[model samples]
Target: MEVIAAVAAGAIASACQNAVLSSWLVSICPQRDYAKELGERLSRNAHIYTPGSDNFAAATTRWSAAHAPEAKLVVIPSIENDVAETVKYANELGMPYLAVNGGHGAIKTVGKMKNGIQIWMHQLNGVELSEDETQAKIGGGAKTKAVTDALWAAGKQTVTGLCECTSILGPGLGGGHGVLQGRYGLVSDQFVSMNIVLADGSLRTIDESSDLWWAMKGAGHNFGIVTSVTSKIYDIIHRDWAYESFIFTGDKVEALYENINSHLPNGGSLPVDIMHYSFFFNNPEVDPNNPLIMFFIIQEGNMIVDPTYTKPFHDLNPIAVDGEGGVFTDLATWMGNANTSPPCKKAGLVNYRFPIDVESYNIPAQRQVYDLFASATKETPALNGSFFLFEGYSTQGVKAIPSESTAYPFRGDNLLISPVINYAAGADAEIDAKAVELGENLRRILHEGSGREEMHTYVNYAYGEETKQNMYGYEQWRQDKLLELKNKYDPERKFSFYAPIV
Candidate 1:
């Protein structure tokens, strides 16, 4: 059966060279316990650790269906040398490489490596806090959960990915968001430096002072592989409170958006420590009539500043359900692992990073935008599980840095829109077409409605080809410099796997 499967897959690969590599590539099994084995191997070579099969499975499965079961050797490289060797071999073979720091991003580039290598980096999990405990030197392959747990153990905290399994470096390379973002800015913002492996099989340590530091923050992946990330850690004192509220359909769609936007307005009197998100989604588990807009509220300090922050939502309609919890790793766990997200069809986003300077979010065109998305969901029952996510990063820590200082352009932008359209099985053409159409349609609606198309996307969420530009709308000069660096450092482009900038 295995041989037959291999032969069949090989035939498919031969037919579609871009999407599948050669059938000769070794298969990594879901049934086998490879994570721990790989983890041990990595630990020995690099004086670091490796991840097990379960971890690898979680990451690999996160790939979109179009790119799943990617061909090529699925090597569980545990050490930096293993990674370098993998790249070197691929380069020598005139092949490409995909670096899976944490299999979270839905980008298809890595999975479409027809005849290349998949370097799983999860084994590089090393975490240590600085002597002063104000900084942490983290392994490049470490997940947000691992880092968070380490920081929490040391009585400290840092900006990191909200999803547990997402790698700090993976998301940091392109400006990551988290609950701490509202307080500490982006995870990238907290980064002090990184030990990156250039595509040329050389290692380079970068910091804010490094000529390439600024570009590395938002456009790091375009340059090389990061083995370690040094980020500023914060003093530990309080684990705050957060609330999750759900509002069902009524006249609440527009009102819900308006109210959420109001609380997070650019000029609002809300505290910088206050953060929240509104997710409009369909719940397959719930009755159809129970369609809901899930609202999440987070306050930095343990003390609740104002219940009124949720008043806008409360006024919209009666809460269908409400759940509140104290901060800690619990919040992180509740959000979910990187490999598994909410039950939604993984349609990516038309990300927007802009100040709430626009007068109203419910303008006719804006309303049309909402209606369009809502209509799309209703019309396509498959997308009923999809949702729109809008997050307001706390300005307390991030705003202090000038936007121009880093590759991220929206330092001062108070609002970020990440719309996700998730659906289930369809013809390849149909799924791809629908996903692309939805992304483009959302972009058009936002631009035409708000007259503001120039915005940065949350790289973690954006999908497909165009997301690169949308997520990194910093400046042409920055992008140009990154490309030049890519040419110089990764001239071979071995590291251009997942959302590779080049």
Candidate 2:
């Protein structure tokens, strides 16, 4: 019976490739019929886009140009029921499918979606505030800026990542890190409830009370498709934030690490209202020979030059300080105009989340990473735009939450790092290979230097090179529990494309 089933599955796949069989399938199990049925059953708002259509192309465009999955059809579901129907129809056809929101995901698993249907959730974007204004319900496809702008208009704020282009729920699912994380915790922590479409085409509302809620907060991308998320919001307390940018030459790289260690002593605690990000890049305008260190310091209050916070950065004596010792602006304005906006065009990108213990920050490893970056950028000029992001956010609030409360296990203190390389489309294969090699080397150096063999990577920043054990958590018990949940919610592992747990 197993042999017969394998042959049957292979035959179906082969038939799906030829036009004659495709036409036959359409005539027998027509997609238009399904569309009509879906429209009638779940409001006539769902929009279907077939191949060779403009909507299809727009829906397929991902933020990273490297991986573009081809689809036979794309459906823009207007509501949760529409999503459920789409999933049911695709399952009936035995067609592989994926759900796309902001299209910012860069993992290689996205490329595995060949000749499938793309359930584009862009039209479901709706941001509404609750009656008491203490909570906000955001549609699954809503972008970071959309949510931030809506909440800002109502004098409210929440924890969200730095980039405004990615989906709000995309980052939150993998334990999102942001400037506000110092005070409130990860965006996943702020989640109150979520509406998810399960693998069996069943719609379910999950809250903290549900047994699956803990898994959904971190490993949700593997379990189901989220249609909407209700997150906790706070009244605007500190509206304006102080921003400071500092640039240092390569010679000052050692000093930079020393100062960071001094300020972030022990790496587990920090001032709740302050956060900083560091970048190492080869900037010809600054110094062509070596990579420059750029620091972006942000303080939650309105004060421009608070001696307590600003003095440490000033003592470093940077080569240049931009923006009048940091501009005082709201979170939304800062994100929109920030220089860290990711390029919309396609490029090769790699990310790894490295944990920084008190002893992890050393001069030799730091210098070696910087020198490696400079060499790679020189070899491929297109990679000059590439840089490493050091996301060392305060973990005070993150650690405050119980370890077993959610599946996001990296709770103590760590710097989320990503080495991104950008080159024109259809660039030389050697250039791309070198770019990837450089990123992998940096990741190895950081991981090994941390004095730990076991590595834990944040799921959102993972490059698909990590195993399920590494991405989920280093603890064996956690892995066992996640596997049990994966079996319970997705027995057949239908939602296995996006960072599969099985």
Candidate 3:
């Protein structure tokens, strides 16, 4: 047992907080000496940032201010070895540490890492393609735009999220959904291998051959800090895409879902090349009482209008239509820009995965959810800009993969519904509480409508309130297997900050 100094006694309120007492464990512990040693062990390209420093502020800036966790120090490693050495040093000092890649995570657990060290991966952003062009090695800190730009330049592409600022690996570790997921699969499905620095400061490569690879596929954040990821890539089959956007009033919610159900019966029959998504929100400019629905349809080919797939949407008589056909890269750029814009910034986002069976579209329940969203926005003006996003990505390719092959459980046909609650900074506590309640209520409604007792949630979009069964799986055997792996790989629970299973 180690004695904590009087100055650090006040910080120890929980087990995690106690982990940070490493700085005060020994009377002779030299803080500057430890930082110096870590610096010497890292490569010349590595950099360190302290609190109040310009680089530190930049490194800690997150998509949502609510998820920014304070750190005693921040280190950006240039290579995998530097990460391993930093982990080893932290372990030696008994200092708690958190690994941050894209800094877009919104779970409350992120804000709980008080007085801990932050292992920033920004300096490790690198992307390289193999000579055969079948695979690309992406650094852990590489964002969606960087990966897409690199692959686009090489006439190749991979599965990545819509937000370009989000890390390629951060979402991939849980389950990456993107425009191309309908044709290919989630980003994790395309993973070939990863270079990870384990909790014990060991550098190891996790591939399909490794027993731990299965766990790394879905619940990877709990295992280790990945330094790089190698995933399968394909040449761009069609550079241009037929993109269409439609806006509808709240009265058309039922018709909108009916059309959506008609297009995606059993959630599996949709054309793999087509991706459909809808956004429901209250825009005062559109209507004060009713929420507006913005539906987007994207097809891989360059047809000005995909007659077979997109004509039905045209029949709905959308309020507005834009962009008959455009380059796929242009579409990606547009999405990235929209997500980072001021209206979308500093928002609290949560997601729920609802499995839609054949002809199981519950219009009543969905309408209620939409109504709840409208009421919430109306009652709280601060949340008027918030919206609910329904991502109906084609899951034929996802279902093609076996459940046992990887740890991703939600591989079947499903609709990922996310409630993005936006509030002004320093908003009243009542507004924040209402936003959380609205998001959870919407999730519950969708879960019950899906006819499943246990709700399934995407790990990346979870708000840290979901049970282990919801995030991992409801089956006992699956839970046992995941727990077994958890014990084997991270018994000490070092990486237990984000959606931890232990």
Candidate 4:
């Protein structure tokens, strides 16, 4: 059976089997020896680690450490049934459990699981191409790099998240976005079927045949743990990819964004082959007084980005210019999201993102946020590591699908803007509170500029404070339907860690 996502990032390959299953067993339940008892229930390949064990720290380590989940025991499941067994064991003990994959989900809500069990899904990274070669059964614990490399070796490709380190399932469950989305749609759109362990610890393979399928595409975290998924795979179409990167000073903020609005609107007029992304970061060496703008124009099937797309930004007098030509795989490395990039590292920093989706960039809003980010980071030296991101992907393919066809809403919005607040771990209480203030303040500027009362946010990048309507959708039907399904499928709310409906 295949499932969607590589939930647990790659695991300790050589240590899949522990020296002694009972050596590191620690009591999870106060009365009974849960680890010693549960370890006997697992398969030979499965292992259990407690607080003092070396693997326990690795299992608990996350991309963002702020407000992370507190687990009494970590279970590394080697097979699909192992996941079921762990969930069942945790349920029988009446302990909160979270299935952690890539460990990149930074939402504060996950921290609510205290004295819980973490089902670390690192051993499920198996991939099998169908005999027809049109589909691949991906392991539930597979990361973007593993799945993409596996499928690419088979001369096939599928829509996946842009980052190489994140689990395809982590982002895929939240309406996965990627460069290929302009052509194939979001990663969730490619789901053919999935083997999910439901809240009751029953393993079930579901697809369009299930009434719960609609919500699974977008709000999957609230349903159950997916152990494996069969996803739609396509023959590699365009291996050739190219990008042009530019670094601009804060002085060019208005002109830079204005150029994007004219060059790359969210409508069908924007070519599907083109996508844009930019970041506002503090690189004091480049501009000591303010943040630097690093903008990128990535194109498919091109050795050089079309001069038509390059000329408008080139005219802005950037501080520096760079370009690269590579295959689809190199895109991750060039964008600094490869498996070895800093984003993949667990550097003990608390990260927060306040994300808002808008149809276009609001020029004055951009300028105002820039100033706010510069001043706040300058005042608090700890937050200098923070960055604000603006993603503008072409929406031709995304918009081609009917808005109501899937659970993912905000199909019309083009820009996914988020203010990422990063501060050193163990920072005092004041810094933590200030980081929240900056993130929310930055998002509010863009939301107010969008000129709409209803604010929409991408669930994947949300800061855990957004309303159900904000992350899901504003329409009455969308909200009503999601809540209705949440009640039916997960009335106990076992899977309500990342993004809960209620």
Give the top-scoring candidate (lDDT).
4
Give one clash count per candidate, in the order shown. 14, 2, 0, 12
Candidate 2 lDDT over 341-388, as tens digits, reads 445333344322232222337678888888888887887786787777
Q: Against the unseen true structure, what C-alpha lDDT does each candidate score? A: 0.63, 0.75, 0.78, 0.88
lDDT sort, best first = 4, 3, 2, 1
Candidate closer to the true structure by lDDT (higher is better), 1 or 2 = 2
Model 2's C-alpha root-mean-square deviation from the true structure amounts to: 4.8
Q: What tens-digit string does per-residue lDDT give for candidate 4 at 245-364?
A: 999999999999999999778676778789999999998887788899999999999989999999999899998999989899999899888988888899999999999999888899
Off by over 4 Å in 1: 1-59, 266-269, 284-291, 303-305, 333-366, 425-428, 453-455, 467-469, 500-502
Per-residue lDDT of 387-448 in model 3, one digit per residue for the tens?
Answer: 78787777877888888787777787467777877676676677778877878888778777
Highest-TM-score candidate: 4
lDDT of 1 at 499: 63
Model 2 alpha-carbon drift over 4 Å, by segment: 1-42, 324-360
Query: How does model 2 fare in lDDT?
Result: 0.75
Under the 3 Å rule for N, CA and C atoms, how many clashes does model 3 have? 0
lDDT of 1: 0.63
By the lDDT metric, which is better: model 1 or model 4?
4
The TM-score, computed over Cα atoms with residue i paired to residue i, of candidate 1 is: 0.80
Question: In model 3, what is the error at residue 347, expressed in angstroms?
Answer: 7.9
Error of 2 at 475 (Å): 1.2
